[model samples]
Target: MTTGLLNKSTSLDMKHLTVFIYLLLSFSTPLALASEKKNILVFFIDDLRPELGCYGQDYINSPNIDALASDGVLFNRAYCQQAICAPSRASMMAGQHPDTLGIYDLTSPLRRTIPDSMTMPRYFFENGYETLSFGKVYHHHTDDREYWTDLPDVPGELYANPRSLESIALLKTQAKTRGVKGVALGRAARGPAFEAADVEDDAYRDCAVANQAINALQRSKDKLFFMCVGFAKPHLPFSAPQRYWDLYRREQFIVPERKLPQGAPLLAFTSWGELRLYQGIPQEGPLSDEQTQELMHGYAACVSFADAQVGKVMAELDRLGLRDNTIVVLWGDHGYKLGEYGLWCKHTNLELDTRVPLILSAPGFAKGERTEALVEMVDVFPTLVKLTGGDIPESCEGTSLEPVLKDPGEATRPYALSQYPRGTKMGYSLRTDGWRYTEWVNIENKKIIARELYDHRDSQESSRNLVELPEYADLVSTLSKQLDTHQRTAARKVKAGQ
Candidate 1:
């Protein structure tokens, strides 16, 4: 045997071989450890308002999220920065505002501005995350599925119809019901049938969504996984299984403490999306008390159903022993309008449409606290990167929430900005610590339509319009200039950082 190969049957020390193997593993283990980076689970839901237990709107039941908030920091004034799904989510993922990217409507794809740029998932993927999502993460129909590493289900199909093809009769029945009169129900079924008979939760989308989510958790790839579970509910059609509806007794549910008369905001016309019509169940002016209660009941039920699925995913994270090391973020894309501001749907500049529920829970996250400082959805991208020890993109406009997430009150953002394209009009809203300012610019007229200012310390619901008050005219002008300057420069400045 050659000198180097002369160890055949030689008396090598067992302890020495063991130590050598251990030494070899020490180097290899970190490479294996690369596979063990922190997992990121973003629990996203659709068209949900921040009026739940965590936001201190005790009108709804949200025990799971409430518990999560109790253990994590909750942002009292978290804004989505955009109202509609496509623009808002695009703004969030790219950490830029819609106007910055020029993704104003559903027709424009985000790739135009951020061509070859890293989005939220892509950024995580660049940082070694095995990114994926179930249900709706981006826009409902236009999201890019290629971003996910492994897509177990088509987002469009997860709830395009709740159940798989099993019973043709029941499926058709639900479809016809939703189709004929179900704008509030969300999308109608896309499947033909299902073999299984309808069970209480079987027909509900979140129930099936939860099942698939749990399975995904159990079979996650070794690399750090980012599972974005998008829950589409309480957005419309206002349908859930009867059980969730039963939870809210008709008698127990309460309507708005007070209703605004049609003429209260003398000049504010509700933009015709005006709450005066279709606030909830009724097709007419703000839902009658009974109908309002019914709509809220459906909404709460859908939220609860989604929450159960969230809990299942959380439990599985723990089951897989990924709890403390993993970062979990649950947020609604944008807030919903439940008969507030004479509006029902979320295409407005009011707080009802701009505010969303944001909860972050993980091992090192500050717990059970609130932040009055401004935070926007765009901040989500930077925060995730910071938390995972990844690079924050120079293009990201948001300030890293690391400072605030670590210390609730110590967080400092002078303002949070939200914007949207209204019907042939554009609106920008700015929310600071003590004042909320909004200005609407008609696209056709190219001039400011309506300007508003609310002193948050005195009026939280914004029931009174401070724009016309002579004493507050200076506040209105100051806020108006700030909003204009921000719109003209924020996006460009963010891009400049890159």
Candidate 2:
């Protein structure tokens, strides 16, 4: 009887051991998968518009960006909060709106506005990710240095052409004659608008930025990283390699009609004083046809040059074997005008300036898909957090775009809002899937000064203002109410600091 009891007891113990082993594997398998967090690679291109070959512009040579779009979901209607570099970038990085931060110009540092606010990079850093910025992640390089794991080493040789250097020398000499000196002198002296030198890509700053970013990727393959590689090209001076310029013919470029939208208020237009700073551009009247065509060609060439840099960085990411577990996002700070509506640069609340190119390529998301869903720059913060399995902060004003990434047919927001400030007046523009409506309001009085409504169903460009047309009165009223409601709600959120 004692021997039989011993055998029975041993069988019971074995059964218990087998059940425990099965339970342990079931629990640990998911835990191991959860622990494998994906890395983030962000490309911040300055003053770029959605005019690449991926966006159906066959004339533009952007193979790298097009390939990126093919590998991910391309957002067809991504709008910036503000159309300028500083405010737009600040809004994006802070995960807040420009109105929330009260930043409308290039000079204001975001830290001054919200000292304790958690930036996207800082959020990643706090969550045990190595965050690094390779180039102009912020409008000013020194703006948010403390938040980054490390900033890229200072680059060399902004311009390579001898004539471009000569123009800078001339501008400095002219400024010195007026008693300008120090930083003020440096600011006053500007270079030519366009340069295409017969030199290597490293002769410009963007190539160096890509090189540094590749080095960062090599060292970061083992760790989860939030790497931001910003490319400063297709921006002012439009300096690029001669080979890139040779990709396009100046005569074949299609120049827009050199006129503002009919029935649009003068306040809706900019003096385009930004373009006048360059040596070749005319200070006052419209550019001649030849000059316009050449500028177009230069812009296109710079776009191609920037695209090549993107290819180099992405190649390194692939070679490092990080592509499978990495999330890649490429976007511009804001859209460029490219002589659209006779405008030369960003700073308007128009579609050409506010709309940006946004692409997201990640493992397990919808691949080779295009989504017409409206997304804003602010939404990027929460989306990244969600993708990385981190908790989105309560202060984040934008919604997570994970669902849209999963199914390209999903709609996250009804419309995207963008704003720009002009002196005492501020323009708030609302873009829906079919139309765009804008209202310019006086800041002090809070009175609506002017309004603009453009029907974008027919064409992307705004040919005329339709706000006063009797047929669209109800639509205008509806959009106006929506804008008011959103602004009021956003204001309350900002005041509460949520």
Candidate 3:
């Protein structure tokens, strides 16, 4: 189960900053080679929305994940700066945004930009962690090889719809298969299970990763460990075993309430159509609403599959008596819009595309606590530094949310931001408790485009576009300016001590 480990080229847009920023961050060793309290287990899932039993979504049966939430702080308002896989993972690992890291697309590896900056697990290793990663934690799979002692399985490399590729090749040969109109989910794959009874989450390559992670946790001891168990489920092939699929009766799952409003003023940069396609869903071709409910049912099953694998590792931590000392963090890279705004996956400024479920459970947070204050995935890096009792590098872009961990409702900032590059400029989304404000800026090109305003109270499902609403004009303008200050300061934060 060797993962796809390779070096990726840098994104053309932010290469200059990445080069300078990379040269700046140095992984300084922890002051004293002595005491540390918690082991960190990050259960990183892919393309999973917070539709688990804990988040109040009734369709999915995810008891293990829900139990973990009950035992920890469930962050209802968490997010990745971008929604794509490699880019999102890189941003979280590096504590940098796509714009700054210059790894916005899957084609580029984060290493090409800032090859020297320490990663999340590497920080612990510098301070005394025996770091091990299984599955996809960072984009450059090769980077994992540098930090991890073992990688049992690689992520999905099956192209041409390995989902349908086998049959498609067959179909291509059969003349009757000509002009195939519909896409098939295709045949099931094969993989090992946690237990003979453990349901397989489709024969996803990630399942093997989960099994390997369990094996590692069971065997690990002594030194403080940073273990990342990444489950590549719910992300694609959208494939999972049929048994769990039978559990979610799709008609019971409701499409979030949404309606295109009249006179909706189009903001200059609001992703009217681009984001849907980014998710592998197309811009046009409205789905003939149906037993697609069943399709969602399958998604629910994938969630359950991921949850079960998470359970496997948690069971191991407890088996090793590491639960009392481990800081367990569960997070999805970014939000996925099932059908909201007609978008299938991610890449949009809306809450559905950017928001993620972040839960931190440890000795200190043993009693359930949560933070309404929005936080970015980048913050997880600095937060780990604080947890490991290590010096935070001067160039880190995020603030430590340790304060919020003490009290889930505590504040780190007035708002949380998610920003990324599009063509020559950057698009920014600022999330406050009550509203979401966004703008697109390109200083070199002298362009500040598109504004987005979503009043969560009135429009939680994000059914209406209020960026152009006369009433919210002042609010949008104010937030747009604030975005400029936020981005500049953050970029400078990463650039500091260079």
Off by over 4 Å in 3: 1-35, 153-165, 171-202, 255-284, 491-498
lDDT of 1 by residue, 1-498 (tens): 675455643436666788889999999998776644578888888888887787887767778888788878888888997877888888888888776777876677778665665688778766666777777777733355567786666433223233443333454577676564455332232232111222466466666677777777777734578778878776665556566665677666657644442323334334433222222223345556776666666677777666766777777777878777778888998887665654566776667778888988766778888877678999988988887777799778777888888888875577888876657777778998778787778877669877767667744566676778889888888888788788668756745645
Can you tell me which runs of candidate 2 are displaced by over 4 Å? 1-34, 182-184
Could you tally the backbone clashes for each prediction?
Answer: 19, 0, 3
Model 3, residue 259: what's the lDDT? Answer: 44
lDDT of 2 by residue, 351-435 (tens): 8899899999989898989999999999999999899888899878888999999999999999999999999999999999899
Candidate 2 vs candidate 3, lDDT winner: 2
Worst 10 residues of 1 by lDDT: 189-198
Q: What TM-score does each of the candidates earn?
A: 0.80, 0.95, 0.81
Candidate 1: stretches off by over 4 Å: 1-36, 140-142, 154-198, 257-284, 444-446, 458-460, 491-498
Ranking of all predicted structures according to lDDT, beginning with the best and ending with the worst: 2, 1, 3
Model 1 lDDT on a 0 to 1 scale? 0.70
Which candidate, 2 or 3, has the higher TM-score? 2
| Candidate 3, 80-101: lDDT as tens digits | 8887788888888878777677
Q: What is the lDDT of residue 370 in candidate 3?
A: 55
Best by TM-score: 2
* lDDT (CA) per prediction: 0.70, 0.90, 0.69
